[model samples]
Target: MARFSYRGRNAQGQEVSGDMEAGSADLVASQLGSQQIIPLSITETETLGARSFKFDQLFAPRKVELDELIIFSRQMYSLTKAGVPIIRAMRGLQGSARSPLLADILGKVGDELESGMSLAGALQQHPKVFGAMFINMIHVGENTGRLDKAFLQLSDYLNMERETRKRIKQATRYPMLVMIAMAVALGVVNFLVIPSFSAVFAKLGADLPWPTLVLIATSNFFVNYWWAILVVLTMGAVTVWQYVQTDEGALKWDRIRLRLPLIGPIFERIALGRFARTFAMMVSAGVPMIQVLGIVSRTVGNRHIGAGIEQMRNGVERGESLLRTAANTQMFSPLVLQMLAVGEETGAIDDLFEEVADFYDQEVDYDLRRLADAIEPILIVALGVMVLILALGVFLPVWELGSVVRS
Candidate 1:
């Protein structure tokens, strides 16, 4: 008999731990199950011929690279769909993994499986890479014997998320570049060009035009107190950062962000996309509806939307239909509520949510592109107007000075 140490939750939901002798880990688990204890971990106690240690195992945290996880999910789904045994598919993945961390995890999972652990149980050991949502979905798939389908769905979801984020970043790139360029241009004019102009006007010993005088005063202030400006900026940024760390401040700020013009709609669409897609995935994966709502609410980045979802969850828990709760929230669009109602009536809520997600994802892409297009012309016009004003301010005085000299 092997000596096994186990940690489990008992019938009363209290944690229990102890050592027991059993024929195998499965036997130990079975014994625990009979005692109404849900075993979380069970490790065998082994006496080695010599003390041995694997430093990698000791320090290894279950971290799989994002790209590696995506590729592994796709490959595993393909292999499993082609009728490869789970263990064999895992072994192939383990052998082919370029990431040492992922490879080690796969190897450990295989070893645990060989010791009679279920796939979901083995995966749960690597919580860093596979979160509770991912693990729960896999467990559901295992129970339903649709592991390949589950992996395919997860891969597709992740791919969509990655692509959406990429598009968002791409859409914002030009505007960000323009803003940085503007800052650099203004900084150069303020620090270097303004000082030279100021010296020239001062030496000319003439009364300056109103615009030039104002500009000179501004430039002198910046030049003489640049250190004070830097200190103020640093302190302001630190204050904002500290305020954002507080829950109340963060919630208030997020609410304000969701109400801002031009940007608010884009933020709403992004949050809606995330909520719809995650809820759809969870529902399709056979997670309970309440649990799906709970996860979706937490995952939505906007606190306002998250709070609305929480209210919807409460309504649903009180025996209201999902569509009814969603409609009552008033945060979701009428189209979304109507489609959800239809889905609820027809028992295709998951499909409806997926459609909603797809629609919003496309909308977000379109909005981002439009926002970029709008921002480019607006920023150009604003910059051009500023430059025109600056030109007049500098040249008007110089022309006046020339007139005075000729007179």
Candidate 2:
């Protein structure tokens, strides 16, 4: 018998993990099923050493995007729904994959399945492309004999996520464009326009107005130290990028983002929407409460919320209801709590969570509509002020000089 490592929730909902001697990983999972335990993952010990290798760091292939996943899921669901075998579906997908990297990954997945590795096990080897959430859901689908439905649910989830992201991008696009325009305008004035005005003022030999003096000094700085400015900005951006890649730094940064004004609530709604929707999907898919919570707590994309969900999972493991545990966390709104309470009572938690997700969707939609109104005015006013400054700083002296020349 081969040794396998497994983690799962026991019949009493307690978290349990240990090494078990079984003929295969599938057999280990079957053993757990016999004990009424929900297996999260079961990996044979022989491959465990190689699984931990940092493939992501070493390979650095083209990263997978949400749109790509959405397309993949949709196609996979259609094929599966049409009764295509998993291997044939994957091979067909490999042939049609838009990205060469994705095609290669699909080919690898098919090869692994050919060699008798479970879908989850094969996908686990490509962590950069597929996350734990994707793997766990596939495992659940495989176990429950609902692989088609699983692909359909994943497709829906990914599509919703993609739409939400598009909305956010739409909401911010105007502001981003405004800032870029302002930057370009400022650069033109600093290097080109201001220098011309400064030369004319110097030729006039007049004592400059304070604004003009300030503008000339700024132009001089841009002219003399532009390289230094560029270097500093580049270095600062790289530093922040690297720092945000670390665990603690990312957690802190995520927390900071949630507290930011005007945008924080948007992200919070996004996180809640994701949680409610994924939770509903998993519940509806017949995944157990413990397994659903375990998978979702890590996939919500917000560290603070994920941590709270994890705490709730542990609470449930200790014989606490999800609602009571959620109440203690104080992360959810009262309306959501009420809905969840009703769901808990009615044994329709999935339906209630779907409603909750819809509510957040409406909230996000409203906020996105309001975001343009909120940010555009501020950006416009800032742009106006900058223009007013440049007019006063550069034109006043030119006006005086022109008046003198005309006279």
Candidate 3:
């Protein structure tokens, strides 16, 4: 047996470290899980007489991407609903996993289960893969003994989210393509076509028109200083990226993005949809209403919306109705607030939230379509205006030269 050193967080969120004799790191992790410790890292310890040597090898954090997680959740739901054992289901998934990370996570989960750790406790160890909301839902499911149904609901929710993102991407594709094409055309004209024409006009022994002169100068600048322009743009992008990484900057930017014209409504809908869906899922899974609001607040994506939800959470904690809090916030529309109020009155808040989410999902789709239609004409007109200016800049000089020649 080899001695291994491990670090982990216990159930109380306290960090703990120790050495154990185990067959492998996986075995060590499984043993720790059985003790209600979520193992973060494990390393082999070697001793050479009086000298001690330690080499640390950290396990990669388990992170299943949205697509993989969705697929796994759906499959698990199906198998479990059909009365398959959790262990057997996980083993089959681990064997079929194309993602090494997912496979490793599933293998570890199975090992932990074999070592007598509850599924929820085992999942809690991998917070990077399964977030607090997800783990809480699973814990509730375990408590209620409806893990399969919960998994199915989570799968459906994730699939809806995936479809929403796909539609948004699709809607933005035309604008992106047009912008890229415009940039490429402009670059070619400035760097190649204009420069060649300028050289020929210069050899004609006639004073070049002012518009042509300006175009030539611009082309020359592009040809000679393109690298400098590229460097500046790259630096600007990197600076913005770094700035947005800060908490305050990210919150500020998210706030600004939510207030943007034409896009703001879409963003608002998307955030609300996420909030409603997540809140519904949490509530349906038996999470406390206050905790549900807190989780939903964090998941809203926009700081303004999250702030509003936070206020609503505080209100709910103070015994105020969720509908009243939502209505007072004024972030949600009247229809949504009314629906929530009715849901509360009927003691079906989860179902109401689900309906709200569905409504906003449809609204988001409509907004995307409207935004796409509006932006296409605007971009086309902008591109046309740019081309017109270029044409005038080049041709105005030629017209002046023609007048001079005729005189």
Candidate 4:
């Protein structure tokens, strides 16, 4: 497919210009005609250098952030509830959108809507901005004529996800800053402080203790081979990044992340909560159970957990009970499994899933609140050990030299 830029006149004789992906210029014109737009020009967008990397784009705002999506969903809920036409609402939103990319996409979606495409179909064109779950929910809303409710549900879900992320960042910020400060201090001491001390110790020409000797040797190594160290670190990072891009590597790494010390269980609960929340939302929206599992799996944020959800989806497709499949994964706590069983029996699984999500969220919130307190003692021990090592390495030599001079 090729992208074509076009300028046209709408039914009200207003100028409308946008880009669309089409097989040819004729197709683009046909699309405009269906929208009651008279095409003035249709030119294929240049693709010769499109594949090449542009340095400026590195710093560009290419993504629509969560805050923007949340705001959009809320505004959409209000507009739709007020009986605003979808095309006009989208055009109005385009003008008010903070992100230029989102504004442009909204304009294109409006164009698509004007061409008689369904709202969900119009949104499906921008996969990068509108996820599968988003499109599916919108499609369900369009069919059920409950678009406002759909947007409201999405707004609530996104808000919850955002809050969870904020809490996680808050919990980890202190530890992250401490670790970074420690790394910077270690570098300065190794390359700067230790060398100056080593020079004085060499001038004393006294027998150096092993601690001082080790410090001096380490400083020399860092100073002399800093470039090699940088190169090796960069290469390792690149290798790991590339590896994580592959399906198997990504799954393995995600699994390993959930096994990480200190924050592992927190991450696990977060993922499970997301899964349950998303599952509940989809099911409540009247999506099929199998499709709900499929969508929830992709949105779960952890590939290992996603894979387990995929297994549940497969089990359900094969006629197995939801509780049985969930139990088989062994990823859920007994309480959660019991909740699933009750939900299955009562046939109010959507409500039970919401409860399950709440249960996980409460656990996650408690953990995040105490995370820093739990980590502080360990960080203090580490910092103290590093200070003790440095003090002994630098000062023990000075004390020995003083004793020798007195003797």
Number of the predicted model whose lDDT against the real structure is largest = 4
Quickly count the clashes in candidate 1. Answer: 0
Using TM-score as the measure, which candidate wins? 4
lDDT of model 2, residue 238: 99
- What lDDT score goes with residue 252 in model 1? 85
- lDDT, candidates in the order shown: 0.82, 0.86, 0.83, 0.90
Residue 142 in model 3: shift from native, Å?
A: 1.3
How close to the true structure is residue 159 of candidate 2, measured as C-alpha lDDT? 88
Candidate 1, residue 365: the lDDT equals: 84
TM-score of 2: 0.82
- Candidate 1: tens digits of C-alpha lDDT, residues 12-125: 887767655566899888967855679999998853333477887687655676678789889988987899988888898999999888997898788756655567767865
In model 3, the runs with Cα more than 4 Å from the true position are: 1-65, 204-214
Query: TM-score of every model?
Result: 0.78, 0.82, 0.82, 0.89
The TM-score of candidate 4 is 0.89
Query: Which 10 successive residues of model 4 have the least lDDT summed?
Result: 45-54
TM accuracy, model 1:
0.78
